[model samples]
Target: MDWDRHNRHIYNKVIDSFAVIGKELASPVVLAENTYSVDEAGILSSVLNSLKVLAGRHELKTHRGACVERTLITSIECISADSRHLKPLIIWPATTHRSTWTTHPTRGWHYGHCGSGYTDTMISLHWI
Candidate 1:
């Protein structure tokens, strides 16, 4: 039961599992809305940041740099409730702007924006 020893490993494994699930559930149209949820969004942000750092280390040419940066910022804003408008929080530059729909535009920017029902306070605390 000393799971603490492998806590980080387990967390990474779980996150990897979720990535597989996201890819499976996501279709040809891998829109941001399909990968909804604060946890998923946060995971994405973390992964993007890690990749960005690694890319910088290895000097890999990546177009995803901008997309990942935008997504990371949006995810942070969503999780932090820093922005009241979910459009900026959920709208990603990964695809065409006009084709995207407004998702969770009232929940104070957090994923699954359930307006006035903030849950990221706990997550933000853990992150800090």
Candidate 2:
């Protein structure tokens, strides 16, 4: 809750300290990852929605997404007559699962129970 107040000349010491600690926590061994650019991120966004289209739904049961390395699909919800919302719930990419997709509670293969795996991993299940 601490933040620098009214002193533009002085650096944000608290934040700077944390920045160094953060770098140390994730050294070269941990800092490695597959990098991506904005365009690639856009494509990932498209990929998830594309999957939703294949599932035959425009409005998802709720927002859901998954990511691995540089390929991240952040959750997005458009409401309030095309309002925009974006939030990343899962930043810690999984190691075992390569492709991340969502399965709605209603669209579950068994109509409710079949989505446990997707729902559990994506954290986007609703109205089962």
Candidate 3:
């Protein structure tokens, strides 16, 4: 095996290109009217995670959330010791069949895996 600088550069370039393409790939947007100010890191991570799920043809799932006052339960939240802040709204389809609310040990909020019959479609949590 040869570890050449050219090979490393090419690998890095491919990864960088993938990241750019992933960002362009849209997700099941939940909130469009709502407002959110996410830093660069958050945006990058969100895009990367979304691409991980949307890379190939995925099965559908259920979509759920409580919408109140133009605010919906965000998919991602950044919390500290005492202050919990919501992250930017994102849209990513559930690859499994368990979208309905499930009981988790730590976080009590999950919106994925809703059973079969979910095809190519976008599911987004929103408020009226």
Candidate 4:
């Protein structure tokens, strides 16, 4: 079985096929690709830093660049200031002070972020 012929084309094809399947099974949301300018990145960084604080992590992002934003809010369950009932989900602007919940929050933030070629490499590594 000279599957390694043509520069291991067959082996690479198999790896690539599994890579697509792996990505599909690992993700539920499809994010649109976009280039983030410096100004937009700054604005996004501010919002993301605030979000991290809300999630209970005080450290801010030091890098300045674009990221393929994915919606992953794992820990949005600490929204109670006083002894009262609150909505299951709340979308409030940073300027609003209507809700009593003000404590900093954090998400699990522990999910694997693998892109197109990562899975193929991962699979290849597993076999090796």
Candidate 5:
């Protein structure tokens, strides 16, 4: 079968299975209190490549290398089934915190730093 058809078949199968399982699951209130969804995303402080610029028809263009200063930070967010969400956590790639990271820190949010700037078991535990 075609790739699209094959994927659609698999998607339908998974959806059907979920519907069957959902029917037998606990009530909404119980699930809402116990179930949580967590998601993470990596952020780069600067653009990796040069941005496009508007110029005249005869203007000369120069190509610059990748951005010189770039920082990688990971953000993790969690929400429960009933729409309650915890404060977002930001992980910086450093051994210690720096004042320059943010002039005004966001209220209620959390910040942490690690060598790799990625979320690990310890960070996850701390968030929980």
Candidate 6:
């Protein structure tokens, strides 16, 4: 493969131009205080497969068939370069909120629900 041809210098130039413009507009400290990095992660409540197990000779069949139900939970976190962070937004896989889920609530964290346990456009807008 021709590395130089595939590397796309135009895209790099565009990014470098943006960097220059950003540096001209704001100082490092001001940028750090105002800019935030956001990220999202998904968690599975249960795994269907187990790596290690101990079973009786007669119970192997039953053990193989056993599996736990899983729920998909999504969490969105935001932080700034100044070492400050906002409370995470948690997304559950339900159409409506469940009170039992938050028996002990987190003080400032936010929660939302959707049919699929993932962040959609509306959820992202609300978070923003």
Q: Assess each prediction's global lDDT (C-alpha) against the native.
A: 0.42, 0.34, 0.36, 0.33, 0.81, 0.83
Better of 2 and 5 by lDDT: 5
**Per-prediction backbone clash count:** 0, 0, 11, 4, 0, 0
Cα deviation of 9, candidate 6, in Å: 25
Clash pairs, model 2 backbone: none
Candidate 4, residue 49: CA error in Å? 76
Model 1 lDDT on a 0 to 1 scale: 0.42
By lDDT rank, best first, the candidates go: 6, 5, 1, 3, 2, 4
Top candidate on lDDT is 6
Residues 1-128 of candidate 6: C-alpha lDDT, one tens digit per residue: 23455476567887899899688658745666777779999998866665646787666666764556789999999998688997899999999999988888899999999999999999888887
Top of the candidates by TM-score = 5
**For model 2, the run of ten residues with the poorest summed lDDT:** 34-43
For model 5, the stretches where C-alpha displacement exceeds 4 angstroms are 1-30, 47-68
TM-score of each: 0.22, 0.17, 0.20, 0.18, 0.64, 0.61
Cα deviation in Å at residue 35, candidate 2? 12
lDDT of 5: 0.81
User: Candidates sorted by TM-score, descending order?
Assistant: 5, 6, 1, 3, 4, 2
- Runs with alpha carbons beyond 4 Å of true place in candidate 4: 3-7, 28-128
Which of 3 and 5 is the better model by TM-score? 5
Worst 10 contiguous positions by lDDT, candidate 4: 35-44
Clashing pairs in 4: 54-105, 55-105, 55-106, 56-105
Comparing 1 with 3 on lDDT, the higher-scoring candidate is: 1
Q: Write the per-residue lDDT of candidate 1 for residues 1-128, one digit (tens) a residue.
A: 23555695688898999899777766766644444434323323333554334444234454345444423323444332232222323423332344233543564442333222232454355433
Two-way TM-score contest, 2 vs 6, winner: 6
Q: After superposition, how far is residue 14 of candidate 1 from its true place, in Å?
A: 2.2
Per-residue lDDT of candidate 2, residues 1-128 (tens digit): 12234365346776798798677656665432322111111224233432333332433434334522234333323222123322222221343433333433222222112212222433433421
